[model samples]
Target: MAEKTGNAFDLNLFKRLLKFTRPYKLVFYFVAIAAILLSGLAVVRPLILQNIIDRAIIPKEEELLLYFVSLMLVALVAEVIFQFLFVYFANWLGQHVIRDIRIKLFNHMVGFKKQYFDKSAVGRLVTRAVSDIETIASIFSEGLFMIISDLLKMIVILGYMFYQSWRLTLFVLLVLPLILYATRVFQKKMKAAFEEVRTQVSNLNSFVQERITGMKIVQLFTREEKEYTNFKQINEKHKKGWIRTVWYNSIFFPIAEMSSSITIGLIVWFGGLQAAQGGVITLGIVVAFIELSQMLFRPLRQIADKFNTLQMGMVAANRVFAILDTKSAIQNNGTIKLEQVEGNIQFNNVRFSYIEAEEVLKGVTMNVNAGETIAIVGATGAGKSTIVNLLSRFYEINSGSILIDGTDIKDIELKSLRSHIALVLQDVFLFADTILNNITLGDPSISEEDVKQAAKEIGIHDFIMSLPNNYLYNVKERGAMLSSGQRQLISFLRAYVTNPGVLILDEATSSVDSYSEQLIQQATEKITEGRTSIVIAHRLATIRNADKIIVMDAGQIVEQGNHQELLQIEGGYYRNLYEVQFVSGIE
Candidate 1:
């Protein structure tokens, strides 16, 4: 929930991130060892060059010169070997750590309560799962280990400079103030810039994802220009955030480069003057100091950039951990496992709401024996859908209990409870996959033959056969290849294949044509036989044959009876509803 991490370096968040490396500790240790070895090797090259210049080139001893040259070659080869190990293992450790974190994050998200998803953006979640996690990987590869290696190199270089000549080392120290001040200011500013950039990236993703998903609404309403303008504004904000970091980099690097150059120039000037005046300074010392100054300054420059990477990883970790810390999952404390669930259901004074102080289902009570079909009918917002939602335990009731058979639903395990129930909604969602896969939903027990048999039983086999590849035909996303009525049929067949003990259809036949309606009617009759079924319908005529019709108004059951038995009551709710639907012929 924090807008940003604590500072450029948040040790707490960094430690939390490093926890992912516990599973790969061997790789972590190897990368650490390689960093130390590379630091040792780094000092060798500069020292060899200094020895070669003063001992071999200046003294004119052929055999000593050859001996020093060969030693320099060996040092160069060793440096290459350790450098390769350091880079490769650091990256390898990063990738493994991120893989473990990504999987754990996704698994945690899957268990969150449905209300959490209802209030959150899918695109924002995608950013956390995909791009933000990718950023955290750099904490290992380029941020942590890389920065450690560079700092070790700088330490060795500074130590060497002091040993060679304390005077030249003091000259190098003069430029440190300017460079250090610039680095401090740069890190603070760049950390803020990267935070802004991450926020804007998440916004950009959310805007694009929503607009693309609802493209039909935009074009149908002829608001494409308005949406395009909105997108441009979001994209511009994202660009500005990134450009601010670029602006900081452009200013900081030049100052660092200038400081480095000034230090080298000062080294040569001071060393040569002292050497001319019969001091300890020599030509080899001057040359070696020049090389050592770059060696120290280059890593200092890289550490700033790597620290920027580390800061970004921290920001991303803070955001990702916010979601992972949410405790909105439904409490599943039931230890009772249902080997079989009878279809009896009862709601005893159930009260609930999606939002606080705005009750949707108010003190409702209902009961149904096993193997009965009940139809619920009401105007919109009459808690028709809420009843079924509670029965399935999708939302916990504010007060009272829902019982499946005789046991409280909260006492039954969730998987075992849901396995006996199948829900078909008016809005059917199908993945972009084959018709067979959509029906079976890749359930290992439901084979292709099972799907075909289910389709035949539901009487939609011929319709599926009319498609290009029959059951193998691709339905595209959300079943876009199928008409609304055809999608309803697929949903019915999907429910049928499950062989659930209780089937609840919510407004399933309200939007279909007469021909599809007839097919659905036949399928419903076949599927609901000998199973407890609850049908919520807007078209009052469809449920005339229900064993019991429960009339609900606002949030309570107003009437309950057989269709004709309720129709006999004078000026009753169901009586008026039935007349209104048949007289107007529209719902």
Candidate 2:
């Protein structure tokens, strides 16, 4: 959640949110006109009731009474129709506006650099895009224009009340300052309370999302009771935040309600007394004043509740706009799109960091010749994966340059640069979708036959065919239905179908069984043939046959040569690393 300073009702944020209504200006006007019509029509029935009491009922004129009754019925029906229009159009406008904002927000989020996502919680972003956006929609549906309508109705009724009898209206006015004072206090308190509630909602959402996604870890460690206790605390805090807002509403509305009821009592006592004492005030005026008093005070009471809606909307808008205003997007300024890239890649003394405090890649330099297979062997934080991520433009390099085919990657169009590369990560993610769709990812350019051919070339076709639905089998969420090695193979097939010029396997064979390793090794050789490949691995045996092997440690390349040449160096980094892995069978 984004923190906004100053007023809780942010006028500037409200204006920015309303800018989405530009495309639907006509609908906006229609909703506004309906509100105006509603406000004016609200006074119609009271005026008719006054006429019936004074002109017909007082003189025992039954026909005249029926006439005024019919007139009142007409006014009621008109009020109903316009009220329907006001609500329906207001909601319709809100839906369309949120549709645009949601699309824009999702598009902006997708373009952000990987580091931004690395630091932010997925649950909070989901809240911004989904539920928080829904909160802002209420601004249009029930906040701004509706508040305007209610205030307008109160003004018209108050004006009528004064015209009828200023003496009686003065009593109503006497109690208004108290209503206004309580409403102001309530609005301010609720504003802060709602912000707290929203923050807690985001906290709850994040906790639930992470725990559910990592349920296997919790159950594996047998920490269910501990996590349950944590959730209970968070949920209880959320309840307390909401109850504070409820407590304010409980205090304020009754104060408002009591003031209105007292005003009505005063009008009855004062107006009835004057009518009996032979003053200008009549029974008809008293009746009209009673109806008019509710019309005046009810909206004054609701204005506070409407301010709650407005305050919530401002908070939601602040958070959403914060996402929209992020400068974390990759600066994709390159216009050069290469139809065929030669796959030669170079990193020239690159220095990069996801955060300022720690540099993940420190002045590292390397080269991969076109059609050469290079292996990077290093410890966990050796910057092996960082090299590939920078090459893929997933994160921007802080210093130095990366070039593809002798051209600076920053000058190569991002789509074009990425189109020439295929990456199969260690932790393969598959959507809950059919195997074929996962491979093609719904790309129309890649036909089903093309997928099958690529799968067969990688030698995983027979394994896939053995399944019940073959290529059509649903892999379930994160490929949960598939074994670890099986998911890796699917990722390979997906990368292969793209037919990229460069291939990257980031520890692709480290976590699989021996049989799957052999299968993956075969697939690797098939895909890397005549293509530039950067293989990151902890298993030293897998990359022994590469054209070159680069040894990295602590974010720097310490050694590089062919495997036999590096092994020939006395107690070299590669030799030492190979010895440890060979002896222990794990890195």
Candidate 3:
């Protein structure tokens, strides 16, 4: 990413943001036309006021006065209509553009590689998708189009001021150079401040989100005071960032107001002298000049404020585009499809790492025939889980190949490959939803009957039915309402309902009570009966009946055999692991 600088307007970034509006170009153009018409109408009101004061009122002609008054009313009504159109269309365009961009950003994020998320902050991404995108919408609703309309209004008013009396116009413009210089300095300062504010907002969001998500850890460690102090520091930084913008505004606006006041004073003093000196200055012209001068300076003040909005929006666009532009590390170039895979899996000299030069899986080779059950046993960080992760293609292997039915998994289409496999992780994650919905996961094709059947097969139907709402019972967030055992049962039902050809249970029974483990083992047997199953378990007792047992140590397979055959080999890795677990009962 390029370093952010103090540029009030980034043309390239603005142009890129405009591409999202292309689909709504007709509405966008209509908004533009409305802005122009509104500016024209703004000038007409001042002219009508000038005509009434100079021609109709001063002449004491009641008929002409009524006629001019009627004309002025018509102009005022027309201005109101155009103003409504301007506000309505500008906001309408902004909403449509933001909707399109938000969808695009979401789609881009969904396709990002797992590695990208590994290093990214969830809170920061949420801020980009929600808060930052909202800021971009203001670039149209309250920034770009508003600024343009104000500028056009100012130009039309200036033209009228000069037309009325050049001498008075010159006097009124004397204080403008000071205002212009102040505006330039203000823009540069506010741009830097707004950028800092955005960064701090994102930081504050990240800190709060992470702390809340891990609140249990905070309470367990009794670190609430420490986390609160840290949060205060982040919030203070955010406060300071916003205060800087306020400070600039506090300084700039008063200067602008004082300059505007001085200009009005100069116009009255000079125009009065011209009238006394027998020049062509009239009461109506002087009155019109006052209105025109206010019109001219009002937009100048607003431009400074609107320009700040525009700058903040450009900064937000830069952050969002940064995510959109990132390329996923895992490429999906395979086109091959499978009607049904036989579930024969092979890992041929597979070597992999989550990070470079920090190998997690060394050159490992393994094979399983169709419909066989294989259990992988290992200590923590011994690459047992990594093996299953590679099988699912969640992360790419560093060397060699992983294959199903003798075809390299890299050659298989990602969606089709993943469709045949179901993974039940040790840490079960259930959405805040009903039991039936959690099991089916919003898959319309998976009927409620199918879910109930799957739950019955897994021995969880009675437990679910014991609840007040039965299958309709809500699990709440991350299944907090359910016990660890209940959540595991739900996950099993979910995996079973999918009817996957291959099942992966990654330490699924390790965290549950003995009764829950028995139930899980029963569910495991039914699910793994006709499928190729790979179970990664730290509890050695859970995999005793495996058709084949593979012992892993330090990212390499050290032993391979059935449970009894491995236990017979004295001091073998599998024997040692089994003795350490079942004999000591410390697992």
Cα lDDT tens digits, model 3, 1-587, are: 42355578888888888888898889889888888887887777678777888788888878888888898889889888888888888888888888898999998888777778999999999999999999998999989999999988878877877888888999888988999999999999999999899999999999999998899999999999999999999999999999999999999999999999898898888887876686899877877888888888889999999999999988898898888888864677778887787899999999999999999999999999999999998889999999988898888899999999988988888888988999999999999999999988888999999888888887888988999799999889999998998899889999999999889999999889888888999999999988999999888778889999999999999999999999899789888877877788776
Give the TM-score of each candidate: 0.97, 0.98, 0.97
Q: Determine the C-alpha RMSD for candidate 3 after optimal superposition of all C-alphas.
A: 1.5
| Per-residue C-alpha lDDT of model 1 across residues 237-335, encoded as one tens digit per residue | 999999999999999999999999999889888998987787888888888889888988888899999999988988888989888888877778877
- Please state the error at residue 384 of candidate 2 in Å: 0.5
User: In candidate 1, residue 23 scores what lDDT?
Assistant: 84
Supply the TM-score for candidate 1. Answer: 0.97
Backbone collision tally, model 3:
0
Q: Which ten residues in a row have the lowest lDDT in candidate 2?
A: 1-10
Indicate the residue-level lDDT of 180 in model 1.
81
Which pairs clash inside model 2?
A: none
What tens-digit string does per-residue lDDT give for candidate 2 at 381-413? 889999999999999988999999899999988
* Poorest lDDT segment (10 consecutive residues) of candidate 3: 1-10
Worst 10 residues of 1 by lDDT: 1-10
